[model samples]
Structures are given as structure tokens and as C-alpha cells.
Target: MERFWKPLLHFGYQQAMSCLFPVIIFVSLAITKVIDVPHLPDYDLLFIICLATQYVMYRSGMESKDELKVICLFHLIGIALEVYKVHHGSWSYPQDGWTKLFGVPLYSGFMYASVASYLCQAWRRLDVTLVGWPKPVWTVPLGAAIYLNFMTHHYVYDIRWVLTALLFIIFFRTVVTYKVLSVTRRMPLAVSFFLIGWFIWLAENIATYLGAWQYPNQREAWTAVSWGKLSSWFLLVIVSFIIVAQLKHVKERREEVPFRASRDSGQEAKRQA
Candidate 1:
């Protein structure tokens, strides 16, 4: 029993560490909602807090520069989505802030960044690797289509379900291998996506309650987000995973290239001698 519980405890600890960014974001949201900070709007304050936390994480070596880049990319992607969604009445930021852009707070992007941060952190902490990953030709296009559908669905027909079906086809054989403590574990890539998406949905509930943003129905009172949004989060998670996976693959290949060059040069010198 001790043996069984030990790995579980370690896994939990690693997961908590992996969630540092998101946990901070959520805590910031709750505190700002309840505590009145004089002259500092809640949204703007949250933004400042996020920036400081990110810098500290990088300076302390908790997050690498590359991970920070990924988080920034997600931040921009999120801001664009927020702008569009707010315009279309999908959700609204009900608070006032100087950082508002087109009625959406600039700090809102950090919510999306938090998701990317979690994925990067968990990947590193768990020593995650993918087996049977599909080619980028398949993944890149799929991720693009998924993100496009998020906006295009409002104007044209929503093909999210179709894209999801394609996800099943593309990653059908992929497996995620991860290490926790002294044990190694494997999970189907699709299952991992669903699990992450479900947890994000749970987090969304807490975030919404703390006035992160509100759906049409949530404007007047706090309520659970629709279950339908789970599918949206699931697709978003795939996009995030694909981007990270491709970047990690490219980084590994680049690192390997220099090592291979040195080895080949040494072999040539030996042959010449």
C-alpha cells in the first residue's frame, strides 16, 4: 500500500507544480474580485500580476525562455479570439479597465496563456513523449482548421464536430508516455486530450464564478458553464498539444544535429589518420 500511495502522491505534487501559472491566475481572479484595490481596476491589476508572475517564473528558472515564447503566442491567439467572441455576444467582460481593447480587457489573454503554460510544464515535469505521432502535414493543418472553426463557426457552419472526428483519425494510434516518480505510465493521446479538456472546463467554472468572463446566461448570476463547451475546450487542447509537440520535435532535432555533426567529424578525422 505504501508503494502504491507513494507514486500517487508524487504524481499529485508534480501536477500541482505544473499548474503553478494557472493556480496563480485563478487565485488572482478570486482575490481581485473580493478585495477592493484603490485606483487599480481588477482587470488591469490581474494583468500586472500575470506579467510579474511570468517574469519571476522565468528568472527563477521555473520556466524556460522557449516555454515563455509559447505562452506569449497563446496570449495573442487568445486575445484575438476574445475580441471576436465579445463582439458577437458570445461572452462579455462586465468590468471596466484601462487595459480594455475594443471592450475586452487585455489581461484576458493570460487565461489562455495559462493553459499553454500548464501543458508545457506538465510535459517537462512528467518527461512526456509521444509515440506514433502523425506527421506535421496532418497535424498542422488540423490545428489550423480547429482554430479557424472557433471563429468561422459564428459566420459559417460550425465544423467543430467534423474537426473532432478528424482528430480521432489523425491521432488514432498515438500514445503518450509519461513518467511519474519512479513509475512510467502510458495513456492514449485522445484520452489525455479529453481529460485535460474536462479539467479546463472545471477550471472555467471557477474562473467564471470569480468574474473572469461570462456567457450570455451567466451575466446576471453565476452558473455552471454549458456542457457543450467541453467539446470546444477539447479541440483547443488538441491545437495546443500539436503546437507544443511540433516545437519540441523541432528543438530535439536541432539539438541532435550538432551532436551528429561533431560525431561525424571525429569519425572522418580517425579515418584520415
Candidate 2:
């Protein structure tokens, strides 16, 4: 029974790979035209690629399902909050083309996946530390502070999503860094990716809407940014750092048995049958 279930789980994950992942990338980019993905939504394509990337990170070791759930929550919640702000008019899109009729932009989910894929790609090299930036005084505030000074004329309002994102950055820089980078950690890439991605949404909650970079058919918010804008940018940098770290941890653990145990066991069991 033990052998049956273990191998079954392994087979299940593999089967899932043939479909579970990659639903976002190919489908989204084609729909949004961020890049040239065909319109079919490439579930298998994305899933296989994600599987490969996930495996590379697995060298760091297997993670718990629970951990993946937490990561997903962080990503989904953070992103959903961002869409709320975008919908509320705290910021605006560059073009109507990229904007969706939904409360947030449709491409928002793609943005989430893009960040996740990037993290998985580098799952091997993405280590992080919360230590003060090399020039802590400057690095601490560069993301937001720079944006604020650069766009003083902008209308940077106080959005809860942006604020939370900012707070998460500070926490990540000084706290979450060690947890994600260390081998003992068990959260899946999804959870780590989501938290880190949520942080990204939190930071960009305003920038994307405020015209930090214009979307299709959207007008730039010349005087739209405020102090809060800076906070959002700051969070983005921190999230980026952590995602990379998780990716690294994944790469480092690949050689270990637990990471690939399921796959091997599955293959062996199939042969026995």
C-alpha cells in the first residue's frame, strides 16, 4: 500500500505536469499580446516547462504541499489586491488594450505567472539575505524613494495593497531571506513564488496604474505618483530578491533523493508491473 501510494503520487505529479502548470503563460501572453504566444493557452507547454524548472529547483529538496498553498495565497491575494487598486483609479493603465473589463487587468494573472516562471528558472541561484543593502541607507529606499523623486508630479495615493507590499519588502529584506535561502525550509516554489510575487504586486500596485510605465492605449499619469509609490517600488525589489533566492535553493537540492524519489519510484513500480 505504501509503495502503491508513493509511486502513485509520483505518477500523479508527472501527469499533472502534462497539464497542471503552464496554463497561464502561453494562454495569457497570446491574449494580452505581451509577447508572441499563440492563442491556444498552451497548458501542456507551460506545464512541461514548469515541471522542468521545478525539477531543477528540487535539487534543493522536496517541499510540502502545504507550503505551496501558502505561496499561492500570497501570490493570489497580493495580486487580487493590486487589481482592486487598479480598478479603483489609484492608478491607470497605459492602454485600454492591455486593460481588462475585470476589476483588475486581465494580464494581471500573467504578471503573476511571469514572476513565478522567472523565479523557477533561477530556482538554483536565487539566494537572499535581509542584511542592509550594501549601502543600506541608499538601498533601503532606492526602489520607492527613487520613484518618488523621479515622479514627484504623480498622484501616488495610499493603497492598502501598496502599503502591505512595502511592509512585506522590509520584512523580506530583513527576515524572509534566511528562511527561503536555507536548506531546512520546506515551502514549495509556488508559496515562495506567491509571497514574493505578492510583494511584487504590492510594490507595483500603484506604478502600473500611475503610469510608471504606460500600458497599451493608456495615458501616463504625469502628476500621479506620491510617497506611497516609492514604497511600492521598494517592495518590488525585495520580492525580486527573494524569488531569486528560492530558485537558487531549488537548484541546490536537485541531487538529493527526496526531490526525485517519487519519479524514480514511479518508474520502478511501472517496470515491476
Candidate 3:
């Protein structure tokens, strides 16, 4: 029973962390729509939700100060992309409020913050570690290029496929080692990116269904978001991974000499298994 319950509890925690933002969106939308606060804007409602979400996180001690800083940075980064994407006609917020920044509602940033929160929570909870982390020379530039391509593709040719190939080259052999219960599990880093991206895409559909943002095609009628966005989310996963990597570096530095040495030795022993 102890062995069975350990993995179950870990899984429950992971799901809770991953669903935190989406659940907030879902419940907030339901409540706001059901109750009438005359003149309370959707954007403002979302802002309150964001604050409440952060407060709950801190009070629960689920996120540390360093993790909060990373989450806030991701919020800003996400907003920058939102501003550009909304301006470029990639997507539109079909609502109005004082919280709007050049057309994007500030609450939009929390969506990205949620991603950071999820990664941070999972890392700590799962005792996650990386093997074969590519050097910054390769990863930093690749992350920058992937982010830049999202904006530049409007004027320049879309190099997403090329970037995707480069991402594979960098991470295909890299493995993510995470523990669940008494056992450790490993998977290729790239595969985790795709799995995460697919889930985010699913969550995006729910967010849109709740009217968080509307793609051009979605403006007239609600439909499933384009499957192509999976690729975009996959690249965004890389960006999220990079940010988490940097944060983890601070934690890793204290443990790397002993930890990595053992982890690497273990990898070698298991190479035949």
C-alpha cells in the first residue's frame, strides 16, 4: 500500500500543478458569468483571479521566492508575445477593460505564469534532473531564434520547420530523469516537449471556449483551434524549458558535483539495460 500510494500522491500533485491555471480560468469564467457585478469587466475579473491565484500559491508554500521570480518573468515574456500576436492579427481579445495594455488584457500574462509555475512545481516534486544538457552556446541561441521566428515569420519566411529540426538535433538525445515513488523514470527531452505541447493545446481550446482569446478563425464561430498551433506550443515549450533550466541551475550548482557524478555513473551502468 505504501508503494502504491506514493506514486499516486506524486501523480495527484503533478496534475494539480499542471491544472492550476486552467482550473482558475474555468471556475472564474463560470462564476463571473453566473453572477452579475454590473460594470465589472472580464479583464478586471481576470486580474483578480491572477492575484488570488498567486496568493493561494504563496500561502500554500508551493512556490518559493525564486520560483515566483521566474513565474513573473514568464508572465512578462508571455505578455510581450500576446501584444505582438494580437497586434499582428494572429489572435484577438474580443473584450474591453481598463486592464488592457495596447489591446491585451494583463490577465493574459498569468497564462504563461501558470506554465512556469507548473514546471517549477514538477521539478521540485519529482526530483527531476537532466542529463546531456546542451551548452548555452547551442541552447540559448536556439531559444532566441525560436522566439524571434514567432514574430518575424510575418515578414520573413517561416522557419519553424527548420527550428524544429534544430531543436531535435539539440535535445533528441537529451534525457529527463524524474522520480516517482521509489522508482526513477526517463524520457527523451524532445518527447516531453511534444507531450507538454499537446496538453497545452488542449488547454488552449478550453481557454478559448471560455472566451479567453480568439484566433481570427474563431472570431465568428467557436471551433477547435488549428492543429498547427501544436508546433507553436512545442517551440514555446522549449522557451519554457530554457527558463526553468536557468532557475534549476541555481539549485543544481549546490548539488551537481556529487549528484551528476552519480547520475552519470548510473546512466552508464544502465546503458546496457
Candidate 4:
């Protein structure tokens, strides 16, 4: 319908911005051999995908006062985790060639930017109904992600880590949900971001598991066989759906409705009095 075109056009512009600069970067990288075009890891391509998604969220028009804290949290979480993992030899590359992105370690900026970008985008696009502030179990997914990051990589058989991961996710979800505290069409950006962000992460996990990119000393994702990988995927997809729904469609609250004439009427009455 005619009404639909407006948002679509907006989304189109957003989608374009999301991809444009990245494309230029990709071309430049390729031209100068900044990033070798390879099948493994797919870092450059993934980064672009995330960037596009971020723009999509930008176009979605969702605003949160807490957005800055959320973004900062991502930087803190991402850089810290990456540094720690690399420190512990949790995962490593076979060669030492990726050392050019912003003068940080090869995977450092790209990884953090990729992850944080997607999170912010998806958060902005999440269904308000699903992302309650200070909710009951929001952290479940975040913690799971961190936990999976650890165990899945090193084959560390720590049951405690698994439990801790689950608990962490629950706590994270709780905190995020608490921020909004109600599941409405007005969920916080963090929850939505997590939903979509995780799906993209699943892509990385699946690809790596399939040997599309090798993680040193890691086996195929057979552990997923034991612990219900498919279920996790399903949950993640469901969360993504909530986010997509929020991004594409959401209901307005009564107070949110601008009362142009009504406001004028109230103002006139106040002036007369």
C-alpha cells in the first residue's frame, strides 16, 4: 500500500548506508591486499553484513536514553573477552598475518566492531513486547553466548562453566529486561539487538563447526550434538523473530500519540483561564 512505501524507502536508504562505506572499504582492502580474499573466517564479508544491519536499525527510528551505556558495555565486553581469550590461548590462528585493522590485533577491531554493530542495530529493532526492562530471564542468552564462547572453543569439559554460562545468560537477560521491565511493543534495543546479533553469531558458529574456517585444535560442533544445538538455534531464531517483528511492526501507546488538536485545545483553555 502507499503507506508501506514510506517506511520501505526509509529502510532502503538505511540499508544502503549500512553497506556503502563497507563496500568501499572492502574494495580498498582487496585492491591493496589489506585483507586477502579467502573462504575461511569470512571476516571482511561478515563485517559488512553487520554494518548493513546496524544501518537498518538506525533507520528503524527506535530511541533509548540508555543506548550509550549499552554501546559502551559492548566495547568493554568485546575487547576484554578477546584479550582474555587470546591471552589464555583459548583460540588462535594458524598464521600471524592479520595485523592491520586500526593498528589493533587482526581480529580485534573487526570482531568488536562486527559484534557491537550488530548488537546495537538489532537492539534498536527489537520487539518492545519481548525486551522488558529488568525482566525475569533475559540474561540467559548473553551468558550462554559467553559460556559457549569459552567451552566450545577449547574443549574444556567444565560442567561448572556450562552452568555458569547459563546463569550468566539468565542474569543478563534479567538485567536487560529490567531496563524496560515490561514486554510490550516497546522493548528495549538491547534485547532486540541480542536476538538478531545472536543469529549472525550462529552463522559464525555453524560455519566454523563445518570447517568453513578452522579454529585451531577444535573439533566439529559435535558437542552441540550432546547439548541440543538445534534447540539453541531454535531459541535464537525465535528471539530474532521478535526483533524482526519489532523492527518491521510495532504498536504505539496512548501517551505516545501526539494530540495536536487536543493539545491546542488544552493550551487555549489554559490561556483563557
Candidate 5:
């Protein structure tokens, strides 16, 4: 029992740490919903809090500079998606803020950034590695298609189910290896993606309850988000994972190049001697 519980506790601790950014965002959302501040609308206040939290995370070395860059990229990507979704009547901010673009609040991007932050933090904390990762030829195009489908589906055919089928086919053999304390664990990459997506769905419910955003059905009165959205989040998680994995792969290759060069130079000198 002691042996089993020890690793479980460590796993929980790491997960909680990885969730720091997300936890902060949710707390801000809840607080802003209840509290009133002079000259600061709730949405703008949430934005300021998010910005400060990001700066502190960087300054205190909670997140590396490269990870921060990834978060920023996701922030912009999320904002673009939000603007499109709002325009198409998918959802609405339903609040006024100077930081809002079109109808979506600027702070909403941080919600997406928190997802990237969690992925980066968990990857580091768990010492995660991939087995049988698909080549970029397969992954890059799939990722691009998934993102584009989010917007195009509104106008053209909704190919989300097709893309999801492709996701399983592409990642079928992939396994994610992660460490929990001294123990290492393995999970199928597809299963991990589903699990993360499900949890994000759960978090979305909480966020909506806290007045983060509202669907058409939720505008008049709060109600559960549609189960159909789970598939959307599942595919979105894959997109985030692919982007981070590609960056990590590129960084590893760049680091290997210098090492290989030095090794070859040493071998040449040995032959000369």
C-alpha cells in the first residue's frame, strides 16, 4: 500500500503543479464574477491578472522563455478562433470591456494559453517521451487540417469527424511514456488525448458556470454544454500536442547536430594521429 500510494501521490502533485496557470485563470474568472473594482471591468481585470501572472511565471523561472513563446502563439491562435466563432454565432462574450476585439474579450486568449502552459509544464514535470511518433509529413498536414476545419466547417462541410478518424489512424501506434516519481508509466497517445480532452470539457463546464463564456442555449440561463463539443476539444488537444512535439523534436535535432559534428572532428583527428 505504501509503495502504491507513494507514486500516486507524486503523480497528483505533478499534475497540480502543471495546472498552476489554469488554476490561476479559473480563480481569476470566479473572483472577477463576484467582485467589483472601480474603473476596471471584470473582463479587463481578468486580462491584467493574466498578464501579470505570465510575467511572474517567466521572471521566477516557472516557465522557460521557449515555453512562453509557445503560450503566446496559442494566445493569438485562440483569439483568432474566438473572433470567428463569435461572428458565426457559436458563442458570445456578452460583456463589455476595452480589451475586447470584436465581441470576444482579449483575456479569453489566456484561457487557451493556459492549455499550452499545462502541456509544456506536464511534459517537463513528467519527463515525457513519445514512442512511435508519426512523421511530420503525416502530423503537420493533419494538424493544419484540424485547425482549418474549425473555421471552414461554418461555411463548408464539417469534416471534423473525418479528421478525427484520421487522428486515430495516424497516432494508433504512438505511446506516451511518463515518469511518476521513480516509476515510469505508459499510455497510448490517443487515450491520453481523449483523457485530456475530457478534462478540458469538464473545465469548460466550470468556466461557463463562472461566466467565462456562454453558448446560445446558455445565454438566457446557464445549462450544460453540448456533449458534441467534446470531440472538438479532443481534436484541439491533438493540435496542441503536435505543435509542442514538433518544437521539441526540432530542438533535439538542432542540439544533436553540434554534438555529431564535434564527434566527427574528434574521429578525424584520431585517424590523423
Candidate 6:
């Protein structure tokens, strides 16, 4: 019983801490309708939430300087996609505010930052390591291709399925090793991708339900996001992971314990000879 509860408590705590930003935003938005802040725009309120969230993370040491950099990078990437998507009618922000950037609320980027925050937090909390992770030569180009497809797919042939297949090729052999309490466990990288994507999809539903953004069909009324979006989120998860990996986690083979020291020993012997 202690063994089971220990791991469960660890998982629950990490998940809750990682979700801090999104929950704050969601609750703030829900309350905005009931409480009137005189002359405050909804988008501005969201902007404030974004700022407050970052401040909280920084002050509480929830995010390190490097992690903050990664989160900012995610925000930039997310905003770039948001600009294009909003312009192309992929989605729309119905409310107006001074902080709008080419029709996207400044706070929209926080959504992506939240993902980065979760990745960074989970890595530290779970003591995660990547085994059999593909070489950077393999993952870097694949990540770029995935990001490109998100843009080109709008005008050209949608090659998302092709990219998805390549993701499996690159990552199928990869395992994510993590510790929970006293136990060490491992899971396939692809499984983690799908699971995170599914949870993000669930979160997306809640965000839309909170009026974070509206799809064309949703302009009239709220509806469930399409199931097909799971695939997109799956792909996006890879993109997020690649960026976080490049900046922080996603250890290579040589970075693992015994091998890391062995390689150093071999190098010393070579130098002596």
C-alpha cells in the first residue's frame, strides 16, 4: 500500500504543479464574466494572467532560467503559428484588446509555454532519462520537417501522415526511463507521445469550453473538438519534445551512467597511449 500510494502521490503532485498556469488562466476567464473590471478588456485580462503566471513560476523557482528560455521559445513558436492560423481562418479570437498581435491575443502564446513548463517540471520531478534516443542528425531534421508541415500543409499537400510515420521510425526504439518514488520504470517514447497528446486534447476541450478560442463551427456554439486533432496534437507533442530535448533533457546514449564514465576512461587510455 505504501509503495502504490507513494508513486501515486508523486504523479499527482507533479501533474498539478505542471498544470498551474493553465488552471489559473481557465479560472480567471470563468470569473471575468461575473466580475466586472471597469474598462478592462478580456484579452487584457488574459495578458495579465500570462504575466502573473510567469511571475509566480519565477518567484517560486518553479522554472529555472534555462527552462524559462525554453518556455519563451515555445511562446514565440506558438505565436508564429497562431498568427498564421488566425489569418488563415483556422481559428479566431472573438474578443478585442490592446494586446492583440495581428489579431491574436498576446496571452495566446502562454498556451504553448504551459506545455514547455510541464515538460521541464516533469523531467525534474520524475528524474527522466532518454535511452536509445535517435541521434540529433535524425531528430533535428525530423523536428524541422514537422514544424514546416504545420505551415506548408495549409497551402500544399498535407504530409502530416508522412511526418507521423517518420516520427515512429525515429522514436519507436526510444524509451523514456523515469523514477516514481522508490521504483524505476520505463515506457516507449511513442506511447508517451500519444498519451500526452490525448491529455492535451482533453485540455483543449476544456479551454474551448472556457472560450479561450473558437473554431468556425464553434462560433455559433461550443462543440467537441474533432477527434482528428489527436493526431495533430500527437505531432505537436513531438515538436515540443524536440525543442525541450535540444535545450535541456532527452539524454543520448553516451550520457547514460556506466557508458558515460566508460567513454571517459577509454578517452584517457587513448591519450596515454
Which candidate number has the best lDDT?
A: 5
Candidate 3, residues 1-273, lDDT tens digits: the string is: 987887888778776875676677667876766676778898798888888888888778877888889989999999999999999999998888889999999999998888888888788877889999988889989999999999999999999999999999988778999987758889999999999899999988988887888888887889998899999999999899987896678666877889888999999999967
Q: In model 1, which runs have C-alpha deviations exceeding 4 angstroms? A: none
lDDT of 2 by residue, 228-251 (tens): 544444444344444434444454
Looking at candidate 2, the ten consecutive residues that score lowest on lDDT are 176-185
Candidate 5 clashes: the total is 0
Per-residue CA lDDT of model 4 for 211-239, tens digit only, reads 32334456433322223343443333333
Residue 132 in model 4: lDDT: 32
Where does candidate 5 clash, by residue pair?
A: none
Q: Provide TM-scores for the models.
A: 0.98, 0.33, 0.88, 0.39, 0.98, 0.89
Q: Which 10-residue window in model 1 sums to the lowest lDDT?
A: 177-186
Model 4: residue 144 alpha-carbon error in angstroms: 10
Cα deviation at 169, candidate 1, in Å, is 0.9
> 1-273, model 6: which lDDT tens digit per residue?
987787888889877877787778778778876776779888898889789889878888988887888889999999999999999999999987899999999999999888888898888878888889787899999999988888898889999999988998889899999887757899999999999999999989988888889999899889999999899899999999988887663444336777878899999999999
On TM-score, who's better, 3 or 5?
A: 5
The deviation in Å at residue 75 for candidate 4 is: 3.2
In angstroms, the error of model 6 at 82 is 0.1
Question: Which model is ahead, 4 or 6, in terms of lDDT?
Answer: 6
Sort all candidates by lDDT, best to worst: 5, 1, 6, 3, 2, 4
> What digit string (tens of lDDT, one per residue) describes model 5 on residues 1-273?
989898989999999999999999999988988888988888999999999999999999999999999999999999999999999999998888999999999999999999999999999999999999999999999999999999999889999999989988999999999999757899999999999999999999999999999999998899998899999999999999999999999999999999999999999999999
Please state every model's RMSD to the true fold in angstroms.
0.8, 15.6, 7.1, 10.3, 0.9, 3.8
Q: Alpha carbon lDDT of residue 145, candidate 3?
A: 95
The list of candidate 3 runs beyond 4 A from truth reads: 1-9, 254-273
